[model samples]
Target: MSEARNTFGKTSITQKSKKLQPRVDLTAMVSVSFLLIVFFMLSSFLSRSNAMDFGMPDKRHIDCGTEPYCLGEDRLYTVLVGINKIVCYEGNRLDFSNETRSFKFNDNLLIKEMISKNQFLKNFYGDKKGLIVIIKPSKESNYGNLVDVLDEMAIVKVPTYAVVDITPEEEKLLADK
Candidate 1:
């Protein structure tokens, strides 16, 4: 816009306002922002589910005719994976005769216990086949605990371990404790 002096030093006529383009170009900014968004979207890692190097037990040997599960009570060890704790015993049932041991989540006590048990069995029976383990996790047990217990089995080189449901008697035993 411009001002023109009319008569007595007074401004009267003026040019129309010119539309000046913005000096800062936002094209670079928009492109940079889009590139950043794309970078993050592509670089971010998606959470993938993982499992132990264990497979389903063979159905061939699960033929304890009358019983719901495999029998061989003497070789079977029961591990009850509870909330932040493991209640374990070496037998089919959590009974009076068999002693039970409980370990916390921290310090890897469960692993140690399993290792000791394995050593004991190896020394006593002089065979790895005798240590059959049945793992039962309560609803309170988390996925990590289950994985830890399974990992401990691998660490102890346990030949036979089965993840199973807790019987009513076993649940009652846990409730009592």
Candidate 2:
């Protein structure tokens, strides 16, 4: 009886020694991670598409054609778009010295402030009937950033607009062209 019990225990030990290593299945995890990456990429693309695009008006628009816009009291507003600042002027000549820097439009607060200001400008100018807003952007500025500024201007309901202060002197000398 003892020998039979010993033989059974030895067989049990032999079976236990031939154990298989535990393996983790990474196939499902890899697939899920890949799907998540693809989803994020697609979502980013879609969000970019929703961003506003503002293109500079053609030179023809600035010409004023047959009937030129009148420059009168309460009729024209000048806007200056600098590298890191935006300021509004009451007339053609903007005073950078006494400039109201705090009220200037910035990338962070541009949209919110511009929308409210547009409503104000619309009513402000509508009281007088007609107005022209001129935009002056720096030469080194990015076109897209310029458009962002213009989009804000448009949101404020600025009717007639123009772009000036671009450096033709530098553009003509560019070797890349």
Candidate 3:
């Protein structure tokens, strides 16, 4: 709200028009501003994205009385994530001779490789649950790299995958490269 008012002054022979000061009431504006702020805050908070559900391996060891649970070497795949490059191999050991292959994040080579390997494993094992992927992220890698690898696993439709800590030997290998 706004208004103008005139004040009385001494009278003189020459008459002059007096200037009035304008007054504005801001109570309604303040209230509306606060309401808008609260509405936006609540809306943003309510619409926030939920965290992704990630499964972690259980630490407790299960005992098989007479039999040992073992996964075949060919079924296991290891992926090591570094700064901008990814190193992958089949089985637990990182063999530089012929098994290890490195890829960059910008390309689709890694995804294609994983899909082919997964398909091969499925056909060779004659079962849907044959491939097991183990992801090991190095210290130089960022969180986005890990998440990208996880996304790759999902894209490849891998049934079983675990995010494990990188071994010292593996770290040394990466450093030497």
Best by lDDT: 3
lDDT of 1 by residue, 94-164 (tens): 66898887778786777777777777778888874547788998877888999888888888889788887
Candidate 1 has a TM-score of 0.60
Per-residue CA lDDT of model 3 for 91-176, tens digit only, reads 87665553677888998998898888888888887776667888999999999999999998888888899888898988876666
For candidate 2, lDDT tens digit of each residue in 1-177?
455335654454344566689999999999999999999999998887655444455565343554344355355566556545555545554334433322334455645644555556568766444446666666655676567677766666655667766444323322112
- Residue range with the least summed lDDT across 10 consecutive positions in model 1: 45-54
Q: Kindly state the number of residue pairs that clash in model 3.
A: 0
Cα lDDT listed for each candidate: 0.77, 0.56, 0.82
Ten-residue region with minimum lDDT total, candidate 3: 61-70
Model 2 weakest lDDT span, ten residues long: 168-177
List per-candidate RMSD values in Å.
9.2, 12.0, 10.1
What are the clashing pairs of model 3?
A: none
Best by TM-score: 3
RMSD of 2: 12.0
Off by over 4 Å in 3: 1-51, 60-69, 95-98
